[model samples]
Target: MSILFQAYPLARAALFSMDAETAHEVTLSTLQRAYDCGVTRKLMHEQPETPTTLMGLTLRNPVGLAAGLDKNGAHIDALGNLGFGFVEVGTVTPRAQPGNPKPRIFRLPRAQALINRLGFNNLGLETFIANVQRSQWRQQGGILGLNIGKNADTPIERAADDYVLGLAGVYPHADYVTVNISSPNTKNLRALQGEDELAALLAQLRDKRAELADQHQRHVPLLVKIAPDLTDAQIDAIADLLPRHGIDGVIATNTTLSRDAVTGLPHAEEAGGLSGPPVHELSLGVIAKLRQRMGTDYPIIGVGGIVSGKQAREKIAAGANAVQVYTGLIYRGPALVSECVQAIRGM
Candidate 1:
């Protein structure tokens, strides 16, 4: 058995005893420390590697650690060591800012779910790039994705400026840069996904990317992260716009503001995007719809509510090029990474 699974119950017990956000911080810090100390390397069992290529980048596997787990890119190597085929960090802004107030993160243990309104909290792009540069993974040729977002205080009308700046800043560091327009916690950020707005925003970003690619002499793929609450009409619009806008891929979900899946559960009404098992069906449906609309080859990175190997496989069957885990990692620990890799490989 993998080391994380063998020791999960104990680690979970200790983690669960603390409040959700505290537990999250402690876990991240500990993982970073463990990884830095070379302790994780010893504890980890031999990982069977699986390679999959997507977006012109050859990943060691199809499983990846989604953004929000490491907003500042502080733990890339540690997470990379856990055997994810790729790792995405941040929803970082142009400047560091404390996100929404405390109690912003709530755990609904009964649902294996979490509601978080952290509004793109990170140590800004410079600090994020610093961490990225410090990672041994960068030199080792690991696949890394950088997720970018506007600061919460930035008005929706001027959001593109932040995105444009963020895109330019992170272009060199990212194997791909995910434009996070669907995070519900950010005020009207989801509005960017509207057909007209999305087209305009993407048009601007695309032009900027062309200039950057010429200057840097490398084209970093761009992907857009969308919300799960979208209707069929909205999903179809996004699919149509993706290729037109020169967008490389799309992450079918950010999270759901809908509590329909977790109604009556504690913290069910907590304000934020709901993630974990509760979002599984919703995210899967979006992936399926996007695949049907986008046709065979468009890359879709599936995420939301994936808590096991079976769910991970379901994502691919629905047409995801690869799958990412955020809440699944919180609920299942690092073992989820390998389990998902094996499951996807089995397919």
Candidate 2:
């Protein structure tokens, strides 16, 4: 184990004492410094190569760092060194905008979860792509997924325009692109998941992908990220639409709007999406349903509330071809990545 991984318990204690977002920024900066000083090199020997292929891309392992942790695509090299098979960045928009007000991120220690209304707050496309372009992650044999979202100000009806724009901008650089219609923070963003809205959006994205694929001379698989708060019928409807629209795969979940598991905990009533242990079952349930509906061959990347090696294995058993993590990394640190990779490797 790396010294950093061994020190995480102590590091997490100090980070946990600060505001969630500030601690997040500090961690990123700290990672950059660690990378620059070659401290992250200590972690290299910790990675166990368990090559897995998903959506035509070969991953070093099935464990990935989920989107939203590095929203601007900055810190890709530092984060990739943490032992993820892939690192997905963004939930970025076409234009830059401040997200919701402060006190937006609350940590619930009792439940081991977080409530965040940070609302796709990112530095926008140009800067995001620039940062992505500067990264050596892909060159270093890591899969890179770029997650795109609509601007909060973008009218929900015209949302395709923003996604189409995002697709074009990131196509040349992405190993895969994720259309994030799942985040609960954006007003009416989830509305896009409705049958009619999703149909229209996918249709447009399909057409755009064809054009971009032809232009780039390479096809980048497009995937969709959905929320865990869906009904059985809603899941059925989405499963029916994905392949028809040329979506290469599905990311089983984002975060949840449900607080059922953490009803009495602090910040349980917070208005954003709930992640960590509280949403684990919900994410697993969604993945199982989607796998049942889409059949065994369809690709499904599971993510939500995975904080342990056993939970990562459960995601695979429940039908996730691969898995990703975010809140778990916040609570468990870099060691969680290798734990998950080792667990999934055994399967």
Q: What is the C-alpha lDDT of each candidate?
A: 0.89, 0.93
**Residue 24, model 1: Cα distance from true site in angstroms:** 1.0
lDDT of 1 by residue, 269-327 (tens): 98999999888899899999999998999999999988899999999999999999999
Clashes of each: 1, 0
Candidate 2 lDDT over residue span 1-347, tens digit each: 56678899999999999999999999999999999898885575468889898988999899998999999999999999888899999989999988999979999988889999999899999999999999998988889999999999989988999999999999999999999999999999999999989999999999999999999899999999999999998998999999999899999799898888998887889899999988999999999999999999999999999999999999999999999999999989998999999899888
> After superposing candidate 1, which stretches have Cα over 4 Å from the reference?
42-45
Candidate 2 off by > 4 Å? none
| Residue 263, model 2, lDDT | 89
